[model samples]
Target: MKTNINNLNQKSIAVDEFFNNALFDKKKGYYSTKNPFGKKGDFVTAPNISDIFSEIIGIWIISTWEKLGKPKKINLVELGPGDGSMAKILVRTFKRFPKFYSSAYFFLYEKSDLLIKIQKKKIKIESNKVFWIKDFKKIKNGPVIFFGNEFFDAIPIKQFQVQKGHYLEKFFRKSKYEIKEFYKKAKNSDEKKLRSFNSLKGLNFIEYPELGFQELDKIIKKILLLSGGILLIDYGYLQSQNLNTLQSIRKHKKNDILKNIYKADITYLVNFNLLSEFFFRNNLKVKKVVTQKFFLEKMGIVERAKILKKNMNKLQVNNLERRLHRLLDRKMMGDLFKVIFAFKSNNDDILGFD
Candidate 1:
């Protein structure tokens, strides 16, 4: 199951293929090899920064379920749940609503065997309520409150650049000189979309997440049938700015993505505009996208911090405060990360949107 990417001895792969191998080749993928979270890891996520993030999410879930008349069976799905930090926090919070907790079945969509082991260890207390899956298709029916935090960005992407009258895709090469070069012409809908976007005037490069869109499409189809909702929180652009946000992280620092290959965490910024459009066209209602700062504020992060502070000593309070600012400061994740909600029903007033 642990396939070495280098063993394939392939070259000039598509950008998607490169990323797919680098981040999720099953045996040697980034997630499979190590625990990439917290201070000890390459990068820390919002949940790792503080429990407030998951607390807010937990509040949203409970409130949304209440608005939906509290379904007897609900699928609480989390995609790419790294380290199981968010699930642990959210599960603990959900327990406050005994009836709701009893009605919920926890499902995690994770493929990395190594990370799955870590997740299993972290959520051992809730092991009976949890289930690991590679596909969401198995969640037959009923309402599903899906959570995808920093999920879309890690999926493979196809990079395209405009030249003359056509769009050329950026592909890799095994040759030393052209190992990281773009020299192929894109076709089909990739060409079509590039042309259409170009007709609007002034566009050069674009990274398309075909697989990401496909995944979203599948999830939406199920959401429509089940009458549930999805909440996605990640660093991305509200508009398609034609900038390549793809980058690599190693040991908590940015590295040249072309050189690092499978050694680092590779990611791109999610395009909220593109996703919102898809949700809208599918007849799903999209909530106003809110920054992490605004979302946390609306969810009472400040109040939660105050209550927690009352129980902490000076040193503990200081550490907690720093974590809070890291999560909410405009200079930090607050402005860069946004929260998006798309749902099947318009009746339930989702919280943390205002």
Candidate 2:
């Protein structure tokens, strides 16, 4: 069954609720209605930019599995696997390591039904090896490795601002004339929760992942019980900055967020520092956060690219070089994107962090 985010007829809803309906309403929502990947779509992901990116992730998975003592039945879940581009390559890359491939069960934890259909079409494997799920209740097993590229940012979040010792939460009230943003008195509980987090201190503006945390709460429970980790790579900041990063992008161009409600991709930057704080609070060990460039270089993406270039023609080599630069260049995804891993284990030797 599809995750219902239907707040359509309702006159007013919270910022996160509006995002949920706009991006994932199961009908006419951006993700539900169209494919938002590649040149034809709103924007392209790293996997579509280059397969080597996914290959690097595939390599990381194997190495991490080894660190986990090679569990007999390891569960690898890709959170919010967009377009299934990365997961498709991961499944193929795993085939080379036959032992690991057979031992691993691939799970795509997705919410968008349209994307799920697209993913199923792209990953045409006829085996019990792969599955799609909305929750973690089914995976009652040895260990679970949950990873996602550009996942958490897509989850809806609540935004707030502090004014003259008064706390107010942002909401989008869809009135008959037009849709506009207005601030309402925030809940006392929300204010208290914000104050409780040390990572969110001294900020006039706040973007709290209210629903996002609820989602992670489930995953955190699974990790504590199963002894595995979650690796997330997304565009976010490690420093505590009071900037509103909420954005709407379509065809690689930014539009006023409220302008294109259910037509454009809505997303915000993930706060790595906040994530670290939350993970620690949940009793999970977090690896040192690193840039995409740092993580990929440590994972040997440069070396992998060199090996691929040798077998390619001049044109192919040039294309490969460009793609590699995009992935590693500080001006592009290299510096803007960040990598973080949180696991419930004594082994902090996971690759791509140090």
What C-alpha lDDT values do all the predictions have? 0.83, 0.90
Q: Which predicted model would earn the best lDDT?
A: 2
lDDT of 2 by residue, 1-354 (tens): 122324433656788887787888766788899899999999998999999999999999999999999888999999988899998999989999999988999999999898899999999885699999999987898899999998899999999998887889987765675776889999999999998999888888999998889989999999999999999999999997899999999989998887777789999999999999999999999999999999999999999989998899999999999999999999999999999999987777898887
- Choose the strongest candidate by TM-score: 2
Over 4 Å off in model 2, which ranges?
1-10, 174-176
The superposed Cα distance between candidate 2 and the true structure at residue 99, in angstroms, equals 1.1
Question: What lDDT would candidate 1 get against the real structure?
Answer: 0.83
User: Candidate 1 — which pairs collide?
Assistant: 2-27, 12-172
TM accuracy, model 2:
0.96
Question: How many clashing pairs per prediction, in order?
Answer: 2, 0
The parts of candidate 1 lying over 4 Å away from their true place are 1-10, 193-202
Task: Give the lowest summed-lDDT range of ten residues in model 1.
Answer: 1-10
Tell me each candidate's RMSD, in Å, in order.
2.6, 2.3
